[model samples]
Each structure stands twice: as C-alpha cells, then as structure tokens.
Target: MTASYGSAEYQGYLRNDAVTIAEVLRLDGYRTLMSGKWHVGGSYKPRESDLWTPGDLAHPTPRQRGFDKFFGTLDGSGSFFFPHYIGEDDCQIAVETDDFYMTDAITDKAVDMIEESVADEKPFFLYLAYTAPHWPLHAKEEDIAKYQGMYRNGWDTLRTSRHEEMLGKNILEGNWEISPRDPTVHSWADEKNRDWEDSRMATYAAMVDCMDQGIGRVMAKLKQLGVDKDTLILFLSDNGGCAEFLAEEGWVESYPDISPEGKKIVQGNIPNLAPGSGKTFQSYEAPWSNVSNAPFRMHKSWVHEGGISTPLIAHWPNGIAQSAIVHTARHVSDIMPTILDVSGASYPKDFDGVGIQNLDGESMFGVFLNGHGEREQPIFWEHEGNCAMREGNWKLVREFGRDWELYNMAFDRTELHNLRDKDQNRAERMIKEYDAWAKKTGVVDWAVICAHPAMDWVKPAKPEI
Candidate 1:
C-alpha cells in the first residue's frame, strides 16, 4: 500500500479488517459522507470489466469502508475536466457536460450532502478531499487569467519573498535559516523558454486558486445551514508540492486519449502547448515546485521537512475559544484519536468479531483546547527508504542508502547543518529507535520491494530524495 502505485490484488486497497474514523462516528449515530479523491481503493478503469467488482472485499469502495454516501474518483490523479474513474456510492458515473469541472462538482456534492443531513436532523461527518493542484495542471480559463503573469518574476524571487513572509507571520522559528535552492536548478536569468516556464507555474497557481474558491463555497453553505459556528473544519494537505514530471512514457495512457467533446488530448509537459486547457495535460515540474516548497529542501515522496511538513488548520468557533499558534508536531495518525476524543466516541477494540489494530497516535484534542500538548513517543517516517526520526528538538534523517544526518530542530529545522559527527552517541541511539519502530510496524526495505517481480513497472532509476 505504501508503493507509488496500487496493485490489482489485496495489497492495493485498504484492508477490510481495519477500522476507519468514519465507521467509529457512524456507529455513534453520525452520518458519514465523503467527496473528491479516494485513492486508497482498487485500480479502477471505466472500460475494464476484469478489474475489482463492486462489493469485492479485496478492493472495497468508500461506501463499503464506512461512508453512508461517496462521490469521487478511485484513482489518484487525472484530468480535472474529464476524470477517468469517478463513482457515486458503488456505481460508476460519467461527466454529463462539457463545462464540468471536478473541483466545483465536488464542492456542490458536499454542500448537497450537508443540507440533506441537516434536513434529517442528524449530526454529519463530511470528508471533503479535494484533488486540486495535483496534476495535469488543468484550470478554467477565468482562473488561469487571474495568475497569468503573476509568476513571471520566476521561482528565485518567489522563494525568497515567501520565506520572508513566513518569517514575518512567525510561521517558522526565527533561528531556522532558509534552505539553499536546489543545486539541480539553474539561475532564473540564465533559463530559456521563460514564458513557457511561467505558464506552467501560472496554471498550477490557478488550480490552487480555484480550489480555494470551492472551499469558500463550502464555508458559505455551512453558514447557510446555521452550523458554521458549531462544526469543526480541519484543513491540511497530504504532502508538500510535487516535483514529478509528466513526460514519462505511458503517462498519457492513464488519462483519456480524447476529450469528452471529441478533441484529441495533448498530453505531457509540452512546452509549445500552453497548459490550463481541457486537452492539455502537463505538470509544473521541479523549478516551480522548488518555490512551492520554498525555504524547505526537497519535495513530496521524501521524509524531509519539505516533503512531510504541512499546516493543520483547525477551525472550530464553538470548540476553539481563542486564536493562538501552536508549534507542536503531529502526525496524520493522530487525527482519528483527536476526533474520538472531541466527539466522546470510544474506539472499539473488536468490531463485528474482527479485532482492530491498536492506535499508534495520541489525541491532539488537548493541543486544540490548551494550545500545547506533549507527545509520549518520538515521531518516525520511512518512505521509499528515505527515513527520519524526531525526538523533541533533535532529528535524525537520511536519504535512501545514505549515512544518517543529525540536526537540532529547535535551531536548525531547515536542516542546514548535519551534527552527526559531533554527536555520535545520540545519532546511534535514534537510529536504533527508528529501526525498532520500523520492525514493529512491518516496514519492508524499499530496495527489496523494488526488486520483487511484481514491481517491474517501477523505474530502475532512483528518484531524487
């Protein structure tokens, strides 16, 4: 499941035995609904009959997992204009109009569900997972026009400006330095095809801007329903900005070859063809991605701060009495426990004769209420063999097959200096701790996994960590 792409077998989908937060809430008399991306399920293609069927245990749909109603694409990334694998509950659906946009449709469905839940007079839990700013770089013409020349200054200036803004807002510690620009990237002044580069980033910004508009609509709906003050809305990204290019062979195969209106799809990062159109499929590659993850080294798929760090914005006018910035480190695993704590719902040890795995995360509800909380254990991460561990202010991290590097996060959260040689004992202890945690969590070696016959699709070339 940790692999980049899902398989056809049971390994591709979320396990049926596992319990979801939605299931816990539904059991406690809350209506659960979800919209947008649901990539944890099986590999689904609208034309394929041989793939996982409805109600199949090996690749269960969102409705089967715990949601009372579900509407979203099963696959990870696709065209915003015409998604490849959209579904309603357990049934596959098609884009009925040429003007259809994925983000707007998702927001509309979420609003409808909220209104229906209010009509029924039942408390509802809605999981609005937007897939904007992911890939294909598709956006509406109006949205694209808003940011057409905004990024002409290039990533260099953008990164520096953004870093300074973060410092001004106190989002980052004062002592933590801004990381150096990625060595792979060249100076903006020396780059050719400046207009094309600007368009790529502009399209990306447009996608994000459109997503923000959708969120605003959702907030308006909540206010209309008179539940805006009581509802707890949590917003967070799954990862940092992505640097992956879409020029690989077979990349276009995953998307539609033609538009719904019978236009040929222009796929890949085609410099000549400007992005943000329904027919064009492109990504805002590494240069702009570097700016997106500004002041932080690396991008998504790595365990570095740039890859893993994301702001968790908790908005609850009724629950969170006062506004205050909390710098406590937390993981996605803590979300379930935090919801349980806030809602007064008990996590069942045994659900319908199946024993559930014990939760690894502690509740962050205390942090929400008191603006501070202490973690009982150190946080650990291992993705594609890029490993890291954080114990209070100290952090140990390394790329795949590289020696461990140590940093004191309190002073150097940007990881500018490696203190591995200065503090060998602490480094050794944390390495051992990470190893123990990985072993207990059943984390397989990334290299070993890549060598397996089933993973032949994975390119031999290692991605930059």
Candidate 2:
C-alpha cells in the first residue's frame, strides 16, 4: 500500500515489519485491498525472464502485512511494459503480452477488486500506490507521443514557469521566491543534447499523465458503484522530485539480459536509444527533477522543503466540503489517525497480546470539514541526517553534514533566507528542540549507521561505463 524503501542497503528491513494502517482498518471490519507498487518488502535483481518465471516472492508481503488482496511488483522500479516481478495475491503472474503497461494493469486489478467488493456489498479500504514518474522512466509510446516537444524550452523555463503558475494559483502560501536553478545544471540554451534531454522530460511527463488517466478511470468506477460520494480519496506523493542522477551504466549490469520475449534488452542512458520502450532503462536525471521541485531547494533524501513537500488532496463529498487548499503542515503519519477518526475506529491498547505503540499523529479529519486546522506539535524530519523541524512558521533545516539554517516561513516558505545568523536565539531554541526529538526517537549517529555492514550498496564514485 505504501512505497517504502525495502532495500536493506539503505534503510533497514524494519521499515516493512511494522503494522500497517490497512491491517488496522481491517480490524475495524473494512475489506482491505491493495494494488500497484509494494516496495516495502522483498528484494530481487530485475530480469525480463522473471516476468513469467516469477522472481523473489519473499516473506512479509502485502498479504502478510494485512491486505486481503494484492497484485503488483515488489521492486522500486521496473519495466512498465513487461515488469519483472508481477504478482496476483500470492501467485506470480506471467507476462505473456507486451501490451501490458503498469499504470493500466495496476488500475485494472484495482477495478477488479472494487467490483468484487461491490458484489459482496462490503465497504472496502483500497490502497492504490502508483510508482509513476519514478526512475527508469518507461512509459507507453502513445502517452510519450502526447508530450513530444512539450519540454523544448528545457528545465530553466519550465522551473520558472511552474513557479509563476503556482504563485498565480495561490498554491503557494507566502512571498516565497523561487530558488535559483541548481548551480550544477547549465542553462537550457547552453545544453548541446537538446533533443535527448527534452525527450527524457517528455517521457517522465507521459508517466504522470498515464497515472492521472488511470486515477480518472478508478474514480469513474467508484461513481458507478455509488461509492464516490462516501468514499474518501486522498492522493499524495511519497517525496519531492528525485534528483539522483543515476547513470544507467552504474546499475544496469545488475539486471538480467535477454528480455521475456528473448530479445536483447538495451539498457542505459544511451543518447541514441530513446527511452519509453520496454527494452530501454533510462532516467531523466537531475535537470528535469530540479524543475519538478521548482521554487524549492534540493530533492528527495534531503531535509529541504522541496525534498519533503507534497500537496495532499482530500475528496469525500459525503463527509467533507468542496475543494480548498490547506496550508497547514502535515506529515505522512497523520494519515492513519485521519482514517481512524473518520471511520470511528479505536486505536487498540494491545493487539494479539502484544502492547501497541501509541499513535504520534494528529488527525486532519477536521481540515476536511473546515478546510484548515493546526497541529500542536511541530513537524520533524530526519532522513540520512538531512534533518528539519517546522514549528508554526519558523523552520530549522540542514542538509547532511551541513550547518543548520533557520527560516521564518511566514514570509518565506521557499526557504530563500537564512535567519540563523540574524536570530541566533531562535536557531538555538529550535536546534535544542530537534536534539530532544532525535534523542526521544532513538535517532543514532548517521556516520555510525552508514558505516554498518549492510550499507555495502554505497559504492564509490567511478565511471560506470
């Protein structure tokens, strides 16, 4: 249901071991179902032959995690056309047809489950996680074609354009200036491989477009089942845009050759080998990713506002009011409490004789009714020592191994100004607060954790080619 980093090479396996919200809802008599990416468990090197043959169907799968039904892949990214680890419930599905695209297929399975739930006349909780717009950006050609020449102006213009649009639409809350283009990226006009670079962005957009189309189909089905008004639909991204410039040659050798149909699979960011095909594995890289997180700094993995920010869309006609953008900071942890509050489900003191951990989330269910609310506690983040804490409008943030920067987000949520030097008092208070939170949460030293034996995946920088 959630797209978690399952690889022990980064975060440890404990991420997948916790009780899921789906399991809790199931205990409340809701029929739990899930489709699409389940990257929280299992690990396997991708291979075309594994499509029909089935790869590592490891323990602690969706079924074990409490979903009654699940169908999807187990890895972070795979061929949308011919995925390597496709599964239906506990069984691995054979990829016999090249016509399959993950966005459509994942939706197809969800619709099937919805129909079954309707036939049984049971209220259901379905978790549909789409790994769209992720790396190894493989999208359908038709979808890709829709975006042809769409990014001709390149990331420079796109970033500024999107920032202006967000400001015009009031999607932004304050006078947050768009952060300058990442210095690492060159000007659009200076880029030599314009066509290839543009094509990569086009493909990435196609993936998002395809996912939107699938979501529309799912919504239509919900309406048809007379559940649209009552069913709560919340959409959110797992993280900000990914800026990890994964050179294909750096990792492609780990995958299996000879695709499912016995064709030699072409992989890498080869300039001539245009992406969007099943045989090719490619990433749009950081230029477009910088645009994706426009007006904000950094990308996924950092504690910058861009890395952790995503808009949450809540739709429930029966229980909530019309569309309204809420600016209150919310964390992913708030989701479970929100669902439980709306469903009138209680957080159990103990489950199956083991004591349950008390919830650390405040429900945003009130926001649905009133369009906005506030949390008493400050939101905190710590990923790989890239840490942040936001209390009201004041924000304290720092990249891994960098000095902390404080910002008064009331007038600058884009984090353009550093108030740490001017207001040392506020910075010290926030840092002290963050230290307490870190200690209470058992956050260990990053250096020690990174040095662990499990982190063997941290390879040295070398020319992959």
Best by TM-score: 1
TM-score of 1: 0.95
lDDT of 1 at 145: 91
Tell me the TM-score of each prediction against the true structure. 0.95, 0.92
lDDT of 1 by residue, 312-423 (tens): 9999998986788888788898899989988888999977689978876889888878878877788999887899998988989999998899999888888889999999
Give model 2's TM-score versus the native structure: 0.92
| Candidate 1: clashing pairs of residues | none
